[model samples]
Target: MADSEQREGMHYLESLPRRWVTLYIPLLLFLFFLLFPFYWMGLTAFKPNAELLSTEDNPFWVVAPTLEHFKKLFIDTSYPSWMWNTIIISVVSTFLSLAASVFAAYAIERLRFKGSHQIGLAIFLAYLVPPSILFIPLATMIFHLGIFDTRWALILTYPTFLIPFCTWLLMGYFRSIPFELEECALIDGATRWQILTRIVLPLAVPGLISAGIFAFTLSWNEFIYALTFVSASENKTVPVGVITELVEGDVYHWGSLMAGALVGSLPVAIMYSFFVEYYVAGMTGAVKE
Candidate 1:
């Protein structure tokens, strides 16, 4: 009986390696799949045009490393203007969305106004509505407003989607906070506005930060609206500008395109890396409620 028990234990121990292999093999493969494109882009960014156009089987390694592509992008192209336009639009839209969402969230979460819950649900549902459905009407509105073919068109359009979802996310987060803290502040003769600004907002800092980061990244990486609304070359955002204008016909400027893409992605990557923990905590807190 003891020998049988020992054999069973040994079998369980031996199965551990198999279980690990089963779990990790798929994960490793998925990681490789996701990473290979970015790796290839990075490699191609460093390669010269000669290497890029070479009909070589393994174009993964740079034959001659050079900053020439980056130089050309900055010096020869209107990339700087496009980048500046993207920055302004993204920053402005993100800030507006964050401000609007926070206040709306606070009101919905804390105030016992009539139909607040229904309103929250309705707003969230509205956000979930497909952009394709609204783009035509939105474009018509933009034309009537006389902001067509301008970056302001994108700035105005973006907040319509961003504000609602961000408000809902933050409403959930804010509801998770204990009412006892607010009650204590009330006892100390604090007004609702004061309490929100001084007490509640500080405690919900992680959630606010997470919402801000989401808004910023979304606005920054937006391509569809930028493409549809703005037609002027100088007013194009990075994503649309690079892909559309850079490569003409079959003459793909692979190295410069890769370099531009890499540079454009850096800000978003850094923002995510820096605020990742806060973002996770915010989402977790929202879920727990």
Candidate 2:
């Protein structure tokens, strides 16, 4: 009776069919749900318009794929410009936010000053303040500063949200590092800047990578600020340009739109592919460990 009772809850699936039913089936379903959109987008981007508009063909697979949509996207539109703007904005804002975050997080975590914990909490609270609440005021500020229609507006405004998030994330990472190392450096006549530069930074690479990825992703996808601050089509980022420019009144350019989305998403995907190791480490709380 004891043996049977223990086996009831603890026994693992012993048969191949049982494991397949319990594990592989669920995983396949989850993957289909997650990846179906990308697959559809790619299919639409390559499908000829006649085939796309036709109802008789199997929508699941493209009967014939062509590069016409891509050709139109690059040759007939300002996709290249939007791509450049997004890349510039995402990269510049990410670096700016990461730099400020590293300093702020180090000060908050290691400087050991009064109300440091309170300050950290305040930063987290600030991040919780949604962009919807902030955009109107930020619009006024951007207009007043005469940067409302330029890439600089996005580059500058993005840091407002990015800093708090990166700072909060890095604060936890910095706290995870040993304080004894800092103390030893101090005793050895190392200045605060030297310790931060030489000791802390090396250990914090994974955290920094994680923060950079977050900042970059947010800046790339931020729509409210981009739509509000930048009105010029030429200066628009991919998110705004793709949605706004591709739609004309009731007519939507589905093929071109899908192409833009597929192209626009490639940079972020590439970035993740390159830094996935550090990002996974950071999320798993394993930096410098």
Candidate 3:
């Protein structure tokens, strides 16, 4: 009877105040940290230059929001072109990386070849090597290939980083699938290519979405390579275009800068909203394996 009472006491729910301290407060703080930047960007985007410059008005809330910054962003600047370039680069790079990663990861995980584990580890390590260092040699190659200052530079270069990470991610997810499934396909006289396309690819949709999302996000936000390889205003991605085109010398266009950022972030936000389930599932499966 005493042990039963002790067990009940141990398993009892916490009081509201204790729960607030242990869970609710920390969750609220995390949400604030994560969401405050977006809120600030939206607030800054709509505020008039007078309100932005003046100190009297409450910075948290905009009293008189205007479309002037957005107008300038869309009309006065080459934002549409930047948006287009970003989309094209991100899409092409993501697809290319996913395609390559599918094959590489399948081979590493399924082929059961010698040193496959070592090779997989090496690929992930390659991803850890910062792009800051790789860009120098990459820039020279881009120059030689005569793709410098062009969209192709970004499209081609993005896969260099994207593939390794995607391959690593897909490798983990692939390992989770039972090998017996592949064995049955092999016994049924399915060719490796046929098995890959018909069996493996179909089962790995969530992993593919997760890897694609990651590759797309990286390509979209990549600034250093975009800045170095593409000098032309029209070819620049959103990140580079906004910073280079909006600010001149000592002056900064905070309103327009925020507008560009808010607009630039929408696609990624929409993507996450749509595929968040698959992303979580893929990561869970990968980690479990």
Candidate 4:
């Protein structure tokens, strides 16, 4: 039945012209829009300053490509330190958020406590609160703790936003899991920790991956918090550091800026490319549940 349905769908676009107008053309246009930024950045990163400013050369294509921008970004700037700071903060925050989210999700979904539904709704609502508002109070707290202008500020404050969303995403996925399994384990005198470790966690790997990816990406790209919290050039994350350090008064290092952006985006892009399948499944499963 499915094969026949697929064949019927294919029949509508069987002709070359029909397929071109209905499928290939639109797909090509979408791909172009999606990938154009990366292409532009890559070209800009390799182009020399002269070609970049010259109207004589084609803007879309490179005339003389040079590695000087990359060299400057690496050798003359604190980009490496910024990158290391981003990695450490993102990874540590992601781990912390996921840990808290797991417990929160499991409790709300499986504990059968009073106001569980309300609590779950509240958690999701917390996620909807804008970071712009929360950052003010967070900044004060970080300053009071004497952790301002340090990587610890970002690592600690990031979970404030990350936990709520991760919890919400995980709650839905946890709901998709059968309650009967936990009930069976309970009858066998298994502890909650045991059941979680030996059963639920094993089954929830996709959900965990999805949550981890979301948390990591958010932490990596986070700018306002990183900027407001950390003032030191070496402590800034990629997003904040690239913008603050590369642009001076009425002058922008376009080549190095593009190089930093291009390089900065690679980690998240590679992560998505690898885990896209699981990410989709986790999102769909959670939403359906």
Candidate 5:
């Protein structure tokens, strides 16, 4: 009975008020910190130019909302094309990266090849190398390949960063699965390919979704390579297109820019909302020896 009372006290942090102070308040603050930027973007997206520029009005609240900015974004610019390019590149590159990462992760984690530890570490280190430095060489390759200024340039280049990180992440998740499953399949005369597709892939859905979400988010927001490689306005992805094309020399379209940014971010937000549970599980899961 003493132990039970202690456990109950611990479970609720000794009282409701203390629990709310420690847990609920911190969580609310974290949510505000994380979500406030998006909220501000939405507010700015809807506020008219007059209200936005006015010094007298409450800056935090939008007194009036207009869709003119969104209308201008879609009708007056190449934003639709940019949106399409972003979607295509993000999806194609995400799938390509996920596929390559899966195979690489399986090989590194399951194959137990010589120097596998070092190779795995090397792959992760490659992910840590800044894109700012790599884009110079990558730009040269894109030019030499004659794919510069095309959507293919970004689709191809994104995997350079995406694959390594996804591979490292998936390697950990794959390690969480039992070797006995694969061993049992092997004993039943299953080929390596069969074991991978039939046994491993099915169980690794959460990890795969997590990796795909990561790859997609990175590809969607990638700016450096996109800017360096694509010169044409129509070929530019949302991140580059929204920022570069919306501004005239010495002039910025604040309203349209905010609208574009808000719209551009919705897809990623929706993707996360859909797979958040799986992504959390995938990140937290680990193997126990």
Candidate 6:
């Protein structure tokens, strides 16, 4: 029996190297593919415009590094206004979405109201409708409301979809939480609002963060609606402003464009990195429970 066990252990040890190699090869390749664009963007951001345009200069290596592009982007252009507009719209819209979704979700998930389940389903289905189809009608509404070409247009329009998806996500997460906790609080004479604010909201932090991050990123990177609603340069978001204003009449400002994109994406990247674990945990917990 000892000899047989020793042989089995040796076989398992030999198989480990093969299994590790198979797993690592694909993982390394995937990482490379995912990160190469970021690497390219960083290198391009520092490269001089001449080097950027020249085929002789290595695309991966910056021969002549300069801050001229960044200077031009910040000082010589309207990038600051664009960035500010994007930040305000994204933050406000995300906050509004969170506030609306949490209460709506709690109602749908906990309160036994008539047609609550149907309403939840309908909201989720409406979220599934693509923005491409809705943008025209939305544009008309924005125009009618006289908010076209303004940042408030984005703030108002973003929540229409964000609220629905966030509501559904929060509903799932809220349902996963045990009702016994709320029941205990209710027995102690806590009002529904008190229980929600004191207990439920605190417990649902992970889901809230995930939902907020999603909403913020969506609002920040949204291009189609930004383009359709805002025509003025001062009111444009980062995504639309960078593409339209930077690249005019085939004179593409590659270095500045890449720099702008890199900077624009940093906030979302930082947000995701901070809340990534919570986002995964919240989603998994909601699904499993």
Best by lDDT: 3
Could you report the Cα RMSD, in angstroms, for every candidate shown? 5.3, 4.6, 4.1, 2.1, 3.4, 4.6
Q: For candidate 6, lDDT tens digit of each residue in 102-146?
A: 999999889969999799878878777888898999999998999
If both were scored by lDDT, which would come out higher, candidate 2 or candidate 6? Answer: 2
Q: Kindly list the per-residue Cα lDDT of model 1 for residues 1-289, writing each as its tens digit.
A: 9988976675555576786688678889999999998898888889987777789646768767999989988988889998899889988998888888888888878985888889888877877787777888888888899999998899998998789867877887788789999999999999999999998889888778887787788888887788888888998999998999889899888889999999888888898899998666655644554
lDDT of 4 at 20: 90
Runs of candidate 4 with Cα error greater than 4 angstroms are 1-10, 282-289
RMSD, model 6, all Cα superposed? 4.6
How are the candidates ranked when ordered by lDDT, highest leading? 3, 4, 2, 5, 6, 1
Q: How far out, in Å, is residue 147 in model 5?
A: 0.8
- What's the lDDT of the predicted structure labeled candidate 6? 0.86
Alpha-carbon deviation at 165 in model 2, angstroms: 0.9
Across residues 1-289, which tens digit of lDDT does each residue of candidate 4 receive?
Answer: 9988976775754888988999899999999999998899999999999999998778999877899999999998999999999999999999999999999999898886899999998997887788899889999999999999988899888998899878988887777789899999999999999999888888888889989997898899998899899898888889998999999888999999999999999999999899998667655654654
Residues 1-289, candidate 5: write the lDDT tens digits: 9988976675843688987998899999999999998889999999999998899999999987999999999999999999999999999999999999999999999998999889998997887788999899988998999998998998998998999878988898789899999999999999999999999999988788878887788888899998899988899899999989999998888889999999999998898889888656545542211
What residue pairs clash in candidate 2, if any at all? none
Which segments of model 5 are wrong by more than 4 Å? 1-33, 281-289
Native-referenced Cα lDDT, model 2? 0.89
lDDT of each: 0.84, 0.89, 0.90, 0.89, 0.88, 0.86
Q: Which candidate is the best by TM-score?
A: 4
In candidate 1, where is summed lDDT lowest over 10 consecutive residues? 280-289
Alpha-carbon TM-score of each model against the true structure: 0.90, 0.91, 0.91, 0.93, 0.89, 0.90
